[model samples]
Target: MSRRPVHSVRSVTAAAAALAAVGALTAAATPASAHAPVHPRAARHVLLLSVDGLHQADLAWYIARHPHSALARLAGGGVEYTHARTTNPSDSFPGMVGQLTGGDPGTTGVYYDDTYSSALLPAGTTKCAGVKPGAEVDLTEDLDKNQDSLDAGQGLSGLPGSILQMTGNPTTLLDPAKLPVDPKTCRPVYPHSYLRVNTVFEVARTAGLRTAWSDKHAAYDILNGPSGKGIQDLFTPEINSKAVGYAAGADWTKDNAGTEQYDGYKVRAVLNEIDGYDHSRTHKVGTPAVFGMNFQSVSTAQKLPASDGLTGGYQAKGVPGPLLAKNLDFVDQQVGALLTELRTRHLADSTTVILSAKHGQSPTDPTALNRIDDGPLLDGLNAAWKAAHPGAGDLVAHAVDDDAMLIWLTDRSQAAADFAKAYLLARSGTGNGIDGKARPFTASGLQTLYAGTAAARYFHARPGDDRVPDLVGVTQYGVVYTGGKGKIAEHGGAHADDLDVPLVVSGAAAPHGVRVDSPVRTTQIAPTILRLLGLDPRSLDAVRIEHTRTLPAR
Candidate 1:
């Protein structure tokens, strides 16, 4: 990640502390709006903005410090959910899936980035009829049938057992060999592959609403392999390989003219689409009714060198920092531009703007800040366990993200499962700087770990999923997962910081300056958007929480 470097540690820390203090004071003093007008007619256009890793608290802080921010301006004129929460294990994939599908892991079947594959292809089959490895299979019908069984823990071994029986095809599971390879390393890349479920774009398109999407990740655009029928146009910096004037082989950089700033490019694309519709460049009516985009530069900036100054350039600038702030500001400016266009074209009153995020980013623990390397903890554990067990099945330990480690035992035996758990517990605190070391668990241990918790409400296992991870390891707060450089920051855990995020609704068609304080989950986003658009949430099995009250029943 290319970012402006910060050179002063002492100054940076002091400045950040000061800024945080001031921000706290400002939040306490600021008065929230008491009431707002609500519009209820079906909206003509819906603009959805997704900012990666945006925290509601951070947003409030940004507004308090920089009242002129686009975010602040929008908030002042819109409704913000003060107490919003995301789904458990709030990782990017699940968060986004929740927004688009309005279903939690239980309903959507997207539990993690690397879930248990149920595909049963013939031996030696590398690809699925030319489809990329790790591609999503259509499991909607199967999921529906086995929902009850899965919830009952009939098949939780993370294998292709019962699910395969339901699907009737053993090779329909996820196969690593089918995952998209990195051009340089020949390894599977992020996102694994496109989703298998019907997303929001598809729903919108089916309703005759034109749509467009701009995201930083290629998988967002590369849905299930190529033909982007759900989305009319997809613009991503990572996949803008064929954009005119773009360097043929250069990597992502500022100099690459074709690679417009992620947010800026998306805003411009949205504005262009609106303009084209207004000028008759495209069909005036039945044109794109929804526009969605993502900005990732802020995440990139966090990984860059801190600037040399009090609070470091990154810390002093705010949560997103200067670079990201500038981009977000630009996004806001473009939002203003779109609003102006809507009003000028007499469309403002009919359009609804919904802003949200995929997940929130937790800052690196200052005490253990620059570590990004994962030691040979897994290897050592496996070596020791294997020496004792002799001919046990292969133990696969994968560091999924910064917070969780998944262990898969290839051989399905009671002895292997018992040994695996004991070994993990013994070596849990061996290498990681975490105070709470890894521990092995039996079926009973899971209950103890989540004693008297809401998490237990949603905990269910399927064949393949349950057996794959006989033992799971968790990192305590401030101890993020490391790949090599040491320990840095990451997500994919069951913590409030990782699961809580902001949900804001702003625009002429929405209720302005109203705040909703309730416990909400990502599964509600899809249904909420649908409801706002005058559609029925029950169509997708998304239950409307009691806290979701429409603006005056307009």
Candidate 2:
């Protein structure tokens, strides 16, 4: 990481106690928005946040219910885009990268937590890296499925370097043993490889801005590039590393915080990073270029697996249950703490705090919760195709099912493609059906869900890119295809419940209490961050491709 001299000139606004006392600021382009004020010096620091699974409706309900929360305070100082939405496959990986890089999964080459890659695993076989179609390098926290390879030589024993950074050198961050390698190609795929574009952090860093970010796992390591190294301080503690909270143990509450244990851990990590120190305060660094963290307690409570904390029923039917509500309150308190920290560090006016969700959970309505298994149907589809072709390989190479299903087909033949599309459409008919049986799959009635979506428009760079999902199926809202234990609500759909999320940008330059009804996508977030810092948003690959606009400021 590059470092400036300790005596480097600091932005007056960053050190100022209030915004009114601050002088005029300037940005890359003069404020071009027909609705924005005259040229103002750009915000100096950015505190981007990803409150995973926070629905637009949920935020409104939360504000309405808890009139005096920090969320309200932040919104009071900024404009919240009521119509902001995550990208198509509204799952965590794609969603986060969508905000960070302004690209859909197709552009990022990432679809879900566990996606199939055409790349083969490394030469030597490892239990974590399966030697097959290859899995997208995502951290689910569990050893088998997560970023165990980036475990700073500690594996699962202690915190992974991806989060804490035990080593001072940022270049050699990950341990080779922890890297995910392709079996056939014998190529080890580092986490950053997942993202196909440079993030705003990288763009900011290249322009001499210090960058930092934290999320649930090191898999977010994707935010690391546009360059070899950008983030000044990166923290990503595995949410699944601890089994006490959600595990059937003595009690998580007894250990201080229940259910919210993971979030609490990240809260501490984020605060530490914000203060320019590592977890242990071993070394001190500068303020930050673009720093942010994600909150998961609310999402965890809403989507708690059956075994986590569900004593009676779902977290809540129409409104949040006690547990979910408490978690929201906890996050709000955390937000307050974050704001206080910013002010304490004299960074209040200069730092833009972006609050939004990576994805939104489904089945917020109990009556809407419905879980279905597409495994049997998918297996049958494979069996039928296998029987017909004999040695043509399985029709379905890999499949990740959320509210939407990303299906990868092994048989790319025209006939097989036609059959698969027909099969999914047949199964996705009225009420989601196959033949005469009702197939509870996808919110969109047709399997051609991707056909008319931006996924097709943007994600499909060229014809038959192996990285592109061959077929996509969206289950009705509240419908899930997997029977994972303890799991309740799920996301990844085109429905409003999964797509619409909060996008609030608040700071000295922001118009207080204003709301932007202008339609915007989460993709605009990266560009907005750049614009906030007086950097050109079009400098980014995806932003240049998407023509993402910056948020309007008064």
Candidate 3:
């Protein structure tokens, strides 16, 4: 059952040199003496899994209650970081990228999937000759060729290959017409091009190691980094697509059960990869050196309301409701299956399993819920701006809001930003504006507002940076910018519940059942993976630029 290692010391050295020639690695990034392999036999393959929305508290609670669960087993036989944190504004796109690139939004140039870029032209704008460069860069299913189809409009002619099947490259699933165009080149920008930093997959593949991954959206093709060919076996099943064996309007994340079904698709893909096959189970490619997928069940369970009259989210801090508990068990069972396959294939001792979450849900305590409608809030601001300056049009270009509000203004002038901020602060109390209705914003929850240079600096960018927002509204912990009854909690904020996630590093070489209390970032996962694989961690561009280090040794 044993096989040769996918990458040898000599091959990695040659590959690193080749990568340096292509500028993926710089001579100064990695010292010459660091090329020597360390812990080569401890980890030949790394299996990384992101269980989205699993908070550190949730992990502790689950491990205490379900001691025999796979997650508990991994923690027992591994090093657990009790103070692990994801990136601020912890959305899936940047959160996952943080782990793969060893950089935050500032260095990665990826803030949110549906974020605004002031330096890009609108999609389908044929003439960028003299047009103003600004557009909403949608990297979600909206960019899919067929947003409603499971295969992203890759028409099916046969059975057993319609869903999660790629006829061509993953980028093909993204409709070019729907992508933002670079005003400089007048060409559509793909997901890979949108990323400013390289990923772990890029480094691994460049070092002659096989790489594969499965995720919820085709947009995750961004993980391919600048080269756009990092992952050899990339399977992206659109989670928002119409669910099979369910109603026509039902998508995977609509409910807990459907999300489990969606996660199961990726689980199967991982199992196939573990068995020395490609993600599709139709190709007999050798086991990948780096491969894994993300589970959406936990996230879905935390957001959607349960049918048994119990709302979603935690009953108390670090506690789970009935539905959430069920999904946790489901994720545990899936991990157990992966471990079983690894043992059966005799790759257990040689493989390192790194389990963590992309982000955590906020308002874990159901009593702290404060849902507000953001539409009226934005409309009021725009109306106030228009009233102040006649024929000025709308002041807001676009606004992405969850628990926090990121506003990109049509005019990035300081005067405009100051005016908006003043107007918002003046009307913080319950009052009617141009909307002629009671204001949704309360003085208590919507107190913190960053404008213009302040907002840019918050994201580590200079004033007027194309990607940085003009105004950022940070809500109180209990406040979620939504007027929906379906969801009780949400992510994408700087709160402890949103950024504090679980990080467990498990392998034969890792210390057993040791808990590290020091604060660690998800961005550390990239360089750590390279270290586990006996490669130069600094070879990754983001790691070099950010000076990211490997996980702390036990």
How well is each residue in 1-554 modelled by candidate 2, as lDDT tens digits? 01112321323233222222222122233322211222244687888888888877777878987777889888877777777789878888888888888777767766777666555443234653444544444334432233323332344444322335433232344444545565644555666765678777777766777766666665566677645476766766545443442336332222214436656656666677678775435667766768878887767677654323433124445577665666677789989998998899888987889999988877677565555666766877787777877776778877777677777666545566667766665553223211123444433333334432323444555456556666766665667555433455678876777787898888856767766554567877876776666666666677655555555432
The residue ranges of model 2 lying beyond 4 angstroms of the native Cα positions read 1-40, 119-186, 244-259, 305-318, 427-460
Assess every candidate by TM-score: 0.65, 0.80, 0.90
For model 1, residues 1-554, the per-residue Cα lDDT tens digits are 01123332233223222212112011111111211112132566677777666667767766787787667767766657665666545666667766766655554455555544323222234434543322222222122212222212233354222211121111222233444343334444323233434555565665666666665443443322112366665543332222223345432332212223334555655665666442113334343666666654444334333211212113432344554455445445666676777678676676667777777654433333323233455575567767877885345433344555444444434566566555544443322322233323222111112211112233333444421233344445444556442223456655455556777767644555655553444555664555455444443422322222222101
Off by over 4 Å in 1: 1-41, 114-197, 221-229, 239-260, 276-287, 305-346, 368-372, 397-399, 412-421, 428-472, 541-554
lDDT accuracy of residue 450 in candidate 2: 49
Clashing pairs in 3: none
Largest TM-score belongs to which candidate? 3
Point out the worst 10-residue segment of candidate 1 by lDDT.
Answer: 21-30
lDDT of each: 0.46, 0.62, 0.79
Model 3 residue 409 CA deviation (Å) reads 0.8
What ordering of candidates by lDDT runs from best to worst?
3, 2, 1
Off by over 4 Å in 3: 1-41, 157-164, 307-311, 428-441
> Per-residue lDDT for 298 in model 3?
94
